[model samples]
Target: MIDFQPISPLQRTWLLELGLERAFLARLPQAQPGGQSAPVAAPAQEAAAAMQTAQPVERHLNDAGSPSPSAPAAATDAMSARDQALAVLRKSGARPVAAAPVEEVVQRPAVLIQPEKAQDMASLLEQVQACQECGLHTGRAQVVFGSELLSEPDWMIIGEAPGTSDDRSAKPFDGKAGLLLQAMLNSAIPNASVYKTHLVKCRPLGNRPPTQEELAACRAFLDAQIRLVQPRRLLAVGHLAAVALSGRDEDLETLRGQALTYTDAQGRSLPLVVTYHPASLLLRPQHKANAWRDLSLLRELQNQP
Candidate 1:
């Protein structure tokens, strides 16, 4: 028979922490203080009852304060499984890793555009609408083609990749910025036949800059557009467009107002001008004067023979 005497508060607290309070209470005597001792349970019976209702305390600690055999085997099996997983990962050259951010790599591939067999703009548009050369195609709502073109375009305005609004509408320069650009063109060169497009047709997720690979992939389409339009002058409206068309890695301010020429795949040279994009001008209205000056330059170039 097991006889348990009254325990101190601290001892009771320790037992509670070990999840043994219920089992301890069950073993407590029901006898009154002045009455004779109540019947006691056998040691094995008490242990069995405790095991049914309370945690297995002996597995966590024994008389020697060491883990039991069952406990050690369980722990060893868990460690062995973890080690085996790590070994497999090591053999396969793969490990748990976090996702990396998408960024533009420094080494840009050489800009190469294979002249498409499609000579007309309609045939080229069909090809561009179904282009899947880059990853941007997967996430795009639709491929944005340029606005309607005249038989002979006076100015071919090239902007950066499509934005959210442009992507949704499937037309280049269809948003507020587009409106501002149209206004600017009307105010600067009235009745000028203009065709607007972007460097890349598809919008980058979250309007982030297109990667070099994306730029290279879409360069062919842009070259094809230039060939088909045969515009007398080219207008590159943003830093990226300016750099790509001029092939100069200088600042926009440096490239602005400078005489630049864009040569197509067929060895045709057209006057190219760099200017502030309408989107940027919207944010920084102070640069409107600079943009106006750029327009003046474009106008001057147009007036020349």
Candidate 2:
């Protein structure tokens, strides 16, 4: 079963005003011929379905960035993992967002990835929405340029890619996982505003892992964000996130709780830590303690001379 991140009461109301989300939009066309309320849900489904059927995908990476035989380990149990992840969140003081209906999401015409020059964040975001660097853009609703860039942030959090709700809201890390992250960040580092974004801006149909070609195409864009943001530390969640950010293909579980470093194209060395994806935390919530250890180490690094 697909799990949507709970949103705040206010956000739920806003989503409602936006015009019925997935479930409501699914029944749109049957209502009226000329007046199907929103275009976001329909086009996404159409284009995504077409892509899913038409292209011969590298199934090894289905649902997470993987070329491994087991895609994010499919044999894992869904029911118990979700329950454990929820318990971890509740213990961490997560503020759950109640469910509400919503309308259209941000949608735009396809554009090409801008030439690789140092453009400001706003300019880069506009260009990314149009970027067609890889096939992932085929069914994209919008580019999650990431949360606002701070002048100089200490931590830059990254995940594999946007999920369904993130695609609709045009916000990275904006689901149940996001609420869990917020709870962790707030309690751990109250004064810091960590910039978060995804390795792939577009959502792969059914939230599968991105293919190698997709990762290669988007690498330049992420590299650009890292350089521009110049974050002091990197918080990479999940195997794919760690691989892309660290440029090391170590098993995610193996790399967890270790001090990892990423060297940018410009030769700047940034400290990074790998941990289970927030979604995975929902899957294997016992790993939350391990993630907490990683976070503690990040703080230690931040205070280092």
What lDDT does model 2 reach?
0.68
- Compose the digit string of candidate 2's lDDT tens values, residues 1-305: 12323333343333234332435323222223454433222233332332222222233344564345653332122212223334434454553343345567888656556635757776677777667778888877877779977877988999998998899998898999899888887767767768998898899988899988888888778888888888888999889988877777789877878788899887889889888888888888898898888778776777776
Residue 168, model 2, lDDT = 90
**What TM-scores do the predictions have?**
0.62, 0.62
Clashes of each: 0, 18
lDDT, candidate 1, 66-162, per-residue tens = 5556565443332332233334344555543433456987985443234467678777877776677899999899988898877678899999999
Query: Worst 10-residue stretch by lDDT in candidate 1?
Result: 76-85
Write down the worst ten-residue block by lDDT for model 2: 74-83
Off by over 4 Å in 2: 1-115
